[model samples]
Target: MTKKIGEPEKDMSFLDHVEELRWHLVRSSAAIFIFGIIAFLMKDFIFNKIIFAPKDPDFITYRAFCKVSRFFGTDGLCIDKIPFTLQSLEMGEQFSVHIWISITVGFIIAFPFIIWEFWKFISPGLYEKERKGAVAFIIVSSFLFFVGVLFGYYVITPLSVNFLGNYSVSELVERNIKINSYISLLRSSVLASGLIFELPIVMYFLTKMGLITPDFLKQYRKHALVIVLILSAVITPPDIVSQVIVSIPILILYEVSIFISKVVLKNELKKELKNG
Candidate 1:
């Protein structure tokens, strides 16, 4: 992609900037397609093991929960089957699901490269120091994203499937869930966490731009807690225990972000003093 040129005041024409962005979009699309093809070829691994895993009684998450419950002398997660069965109403439903799921999988695997392409596009406009410090952007961001995805897949998704799938009013009422519904839950949980784990990165940029400060974060600490609790409720099952458990790590991340903001502010001050 062509670099954005000219000074801050005399920017590249809007069309020129758009043209440059177009090329980046094109490259990113091609990358996603390439990865999608790879995912399509791995159908057995993707579907049997990964996608349908939560439906199995002996899935790793269920086993882990069972172990925890046995140790604590509480109710365990072991079950013979989910009360629900997945079905496709449309003729092309399975094929459509396969293609879309493959593309999303492609996006996840190609995420680092996509972020690198974004950084490349924006690097030309950044000061040298800013660019240097951001050399690890793709690696760090990708690591956080994968961590979030794992958390979602292993913890959140399983908990949800177990709780919701087994919940019933009576034996007369059987749950017949759709494939789309199940996949949607898994996808949303994974993608949301993947993006949420970039919290520190988002804070870092705002800190660098002087748009946010440690003091600001500290001032709104209680408010942040409420927001976090609300967010936890939104994403997780309606159980308070589950919400609290998930919120803990996220709150910890916010605290860490505050520390990072403080360090960044101090460094900025030192640089100013040195220049002066």
Candidate 2:
């Protein structure tokens, strides 16, 4: 028989545990599928308002950058236009892109449900006190993910699109970007940023399992900075301004992870003392 929620986990056999996990995966997949359908139905909004928005000179990010540039007594950051045209070179490319974009949107919209399913699978192994923090974990993680998505969309995506779209090797060269390539860049930026923002949660769990400690994180702080800069360079456009902007938030997240690890370790120590 399948183990019900709140049932004692001790009674579950190995097979039963596998069965439970399978059900959680099924539900998560179903949620993603349902959301994907919804996204597929909203084609105009997704394509025109979201996917193509960054290419416009009057986009919110571009406007904001222009204001900042003007405030600094220069129009260096002002974007006039993105000098590129998106083309679909294959017959079924547009259809394929539509399906993939819908799936990506579905996954993003269903992220909370996916996290809940994952928590359900693992919560059985945690202590009661730890389990009680489930709601907080879900809320904080989801919030951070959304914030990171917005940051990627508004900051990194614009910087990258503007620079790459306008770049030219020579006056004779024209930029005709493939739709697949453009979408791929945007998707990677958004998803990578969202996952990177979960640093604190990952640190807490690693600390709880005694796999890592705050000292370990602190000792490698400089190393982490180097890695963050490297990561920023890889993700954003090859410009000092773009790389620095991306690196700052990631470095902040790393520091926050260290603090989270410290707190988790202290709490673990207190619990051990009480038991001893």
Candidate 3:
């Protein structure tokens, strides 16, 4: 009998598996650190250009919004000023924020490699067909993550900044946005969106485990819509446009997840039929 690819061809002890996982984690961490160093060196471009892009009126999203507003003859969508200034009050706040931001950026930059390492570790337990899908898994997951990051940066971040940056309980109180606060918002928006975009991947695993089916997704789609709306509200500002913008992609992802579950179930059934 021929041994399958990724199969050890011999039973490995628990300690051996643990050692393998540790090495995979070590490699993933090294990749993150290398990317982080690069990000740290490019602080000027990262912070001034990328992180702070949404604050400027000429940001790509803002420009698109302006053009759309003009075409519709509606002045409501045009954002002229984000009525807040970012300030660092604590003496070490800027340094701390810089380090954290670089680390986060590094993780984002190295995400694909990290995923590859994880796949390598897990692939040994998967079937030959599943092992063959490694490249597709990494590519699709990476593409989805980057897309989510861009959506958060260009859409959710701007809307939140515009709303919170301008919102004032009273005319007496001026918005003095702290450096840490701003960075936190930016980090959360990007990271949260990136993870949320992995819905289909999550569904595939759940279906494989026989935990959820496509019928379940369809039956509870209304409930999912309500949850998505609540999630949009939590992530975005209190504006309808921002909420709608965030909700749309998430809803689409949910539908795609359902389709993924259906496919997974179909494949499993076919496998069982062939074996029987």
Candidate 4:
């Protein structure tokens, strides 16, 4: 059984702890399955409205880019169309893709519940004060993840689709993009951005564990910039605008991580001094 908040802590054997974890996993999986079924039922909206939105020339991101270009007295940034066709060659490809896409959407939608399960499993090991911060942690983490997802969907996906879809090495080569390939690109972008945005949270926990310090982050800031640029290049299309846009937020997150580490260390120091 799940422990209620503010209840007295109970000690358990290793096997008992494993049993507790099993239940948490079961519940989290159940939540994902339920959401997946809902996504399966909403196939049309999930596919045409969301997964394929970046390919449209009139997607919000593209239109915003066009407006920015017009403000600068140029229409060069405007995309008229994505010069590629998405096709499925195999007979069972569409059905398989549909099932996988539903599961992916379900995972995204159920992320908060997954995090809650994670917190509950771990909170028993934390101090009373730390356990009380569960609500804050869940809210902040979920907010960052969703923001990252939107950034990927709106900013990164459109830029990449526009660049790669228009790229041509030879007139003889036709851009018949496989449906699986297109979906893979979109999935990677959205999921990668969501995880990348968790840098500060990761730093906080690392600091608590004495694994990292603010000074360490500061000293490696230049190296981190290089890595971020390389990562940006990998995730985004080979364009300066796309790389810069992606890099800016990641760098900001790195800086925010440093600050979070500093705060965590300071709090720890205060606790040590009080105890001493």
Worst 10 residues of 1 by lDDT: 1-10
Q: Sort by lDDT, best first.
A: 4, 2, 3, 1
| After superposition, candidate 4 runs with Cα above 4 Å error | 1-14
Pairs that collide, model 2: none
Error (Å) of candidate 1 at residue 52 is: 0.9
lDDT per residue as tens, model 1, 59-137: 9988887888778887654566767888888898888889988998999998888888888778778766667755588
Error of 4 at 24 (Å): 1.9
TM-score per candidate, chains pooled? 0.92, 0.96, 0.95, 0.95
Give per-residue CA lDDT, model 2, range 1-276, as digits (tens). 223347583688999999999999999999999999999999999999998899899999999989999999999988777889999999999999999999989988998999999999998777777788889989998888888888889999999999999989998987999999999999999989988998888888899889999999999999999999999999999999999999999999999999999889899888888878
- Clash totals for all models, in order? 0, 0, 0, 0
Error of 4 at 246 (Å): 0.3
Off by over 4 Å in 1: 1-11, 77-80
Between prediction 2 and prediction 4, the one with superior lDDT is 4
Q: Look at candidate 2 and tell me the lDDT of residue 171.
A: 83
- State the C-alpha lDDT per candidate: 0.85, 0.91, 0.90, 0.92
